[model samples]
Target: MQAYKQSLKHETFSYLPQMTPEQVRRQIAYALAQGWNPAVEHTERGTPAKESYWYMWKLPMFGEQSVDAVLAEIEACHREFPNHMVRFVAYDNYAQSQGLTFVVYR
Candidate 1:
């Protein structure tokens, strides 16, 4: 008989405590003040894998200047994926693909 080996499971990265609506709003406002465009993304909570890549719910856009607009999008995403992890991403025009991201809900 041959002995079988089992693969070990690893935990994924995550914010220990999720942020609230108010906290998210403040973050959005700060990002806007810094000229960063807001975007929303969500993914099912699980180990990181090709399929676990963040799915964009809304592309980063500057047309809407108000934080409320970004907040609205966040709310919409929450409704769509109430059980999954949702994040707010702020992109700096000069930074191109680089951006600040944080988990707003999970």
Candidate 2:
């Protein structure tokens, strides 16, 4: 069997559309549906009223360095809207395995 780890760190982004939390949750779920597993989700919000500072993300470790594959999906999703930003850090159980992505929705 293959052993892998999925880790995600969330950071505040600009103002999103609506239900930013749910949107991120669904995004993670969708990624899991894409031949990925052990998905981990994390979220952080600046302030309730701060529409431009909500964050959520998904981490998928496919037993290999698949940052490009994972980020590609997320990038495509965020690109759908002209005003959506996403940021996250991905890593494995090892300190040597880690990646960071900062997508801005401007």
How many residue pairs clash per model?
A: 0, 4
**Model 2: residues with Cα > 4 Å off, grouped in runs:** 1-59, 62-64, 92-106
TM-score of each: 0.75, 0.32
Report the Cα lDDT for candidate 1.
0.71
Worst 10 residues of 2 by lDDT: 5-14
Question: Which model scores highest in lDDT?
Answer: 1
Best by TM-score: 1
- Regions more than 4 Å wrong, model 1: 1-16, 50-52
